[model samples]
Target: MPKITYTQPDGVQSVVDVNEGDSVMRGAVLNGVPGIVAQCGGGASCGTCHVYVDKDNTKPLPEMHPVEDELLHCTSSPRQDNSRLSCQLPVSAELDGLVVHVPETQI
Candidate 1:
């Protein structure tokens, strides 16, 4: 399992131990974390699972595909340099201690 930290815009945090192959959205949704909406489940078709990867975290994430890039533009929150769809981020040993910030809104 990988321990991932999800931080809310209000500074609240939820630390969850996600199964190795599950997506970040899966971890948050299963644990009742308040910030991730995950409207499309893990399909990557919706931008509701938007999150900001911690700039200080050095772990490299997977390259974003064209679809995800396009969908990011549709997020209710402003897209950022570290913006990523939680559904696109899989859990792994290398991702332990990963911290992601939830934007103020997801629609």
Candidate 2:
């Protein structure tokens, strides 16, 4: 399992153990982390699972896909250089301790 940390706008953090092949959004959703909406259930179309990959922790993540590239622009939060959709990020050993920041709103 990979351990990930999700930080909310208020600085609160939720650390979760994610199964190897599960999406990061699934971990947050299953653990009841408040900021990740995941409305489309990991579908790339929703953009509701938007998160900011901590700039210092992003290098180990896989490259962003083309669909994720497009949907990121649809998030309610202003997109930053590190913006990413949690649903598009898969858990892996290389990404252990990955930290993502949740936006204030997903809608």
Candidate 3:
């Protein structure tokens, strides 16, 4: 299983073990990470799962896809260079130590 840490704006952190092939968003949602509300499931149709990939592992993560780009623009929060839709990240051996930061809110 790949391990991921989701840190909220208030500094609350939730670390979850995710099965290979599962989206990081799904892992957050399933584990009850408060800052993530995956309203569009893993479709990338909504940006409720927006998060910032940790800079250390950001280069190792997959590049954003077109659909993810579109949805990322929907986030109510301002986007940053490292902004990403968690649904676009797949759980895998290469992402064993991925860290993501959940903004204060995503509506």
lDDT of 1 at 24: 93
lDDT, candidate 2, 14-49, per-residue tens? 999999899899999999999888888998999999
TM-score, structure 3 vs. true:
0.92
- lDDT per residue for candidate 1 within 12-31, as digits (tens), equals 99999999999999999999
Tens digit per residue, CA lDDT, model 3, 12-102? 7888999899989999988888878888787888899999987676437787788888777778888888899988888888888788999
Give per-residue lDDT, candidate 1, residue 52.
96
Candidates' C-alpha lDDT:
0.94, 0.91, 0.85
Better of 2 and 3 by TM-score: 2
Strongest candidate by lDDT: 1
Model 1 poorest 10 in a row by lDDT: 52-61
Say which candidate scores most in TM-score: 1
Off by over 4 Å in 1: none
Name the better of 1 and 3 by lDDT.
Answer: 1
lDDT of 1: 0.94
TM-score of each: 0.98, 0.95, 0.92
Candidates 1 and 2: which is better by lDDT? 1
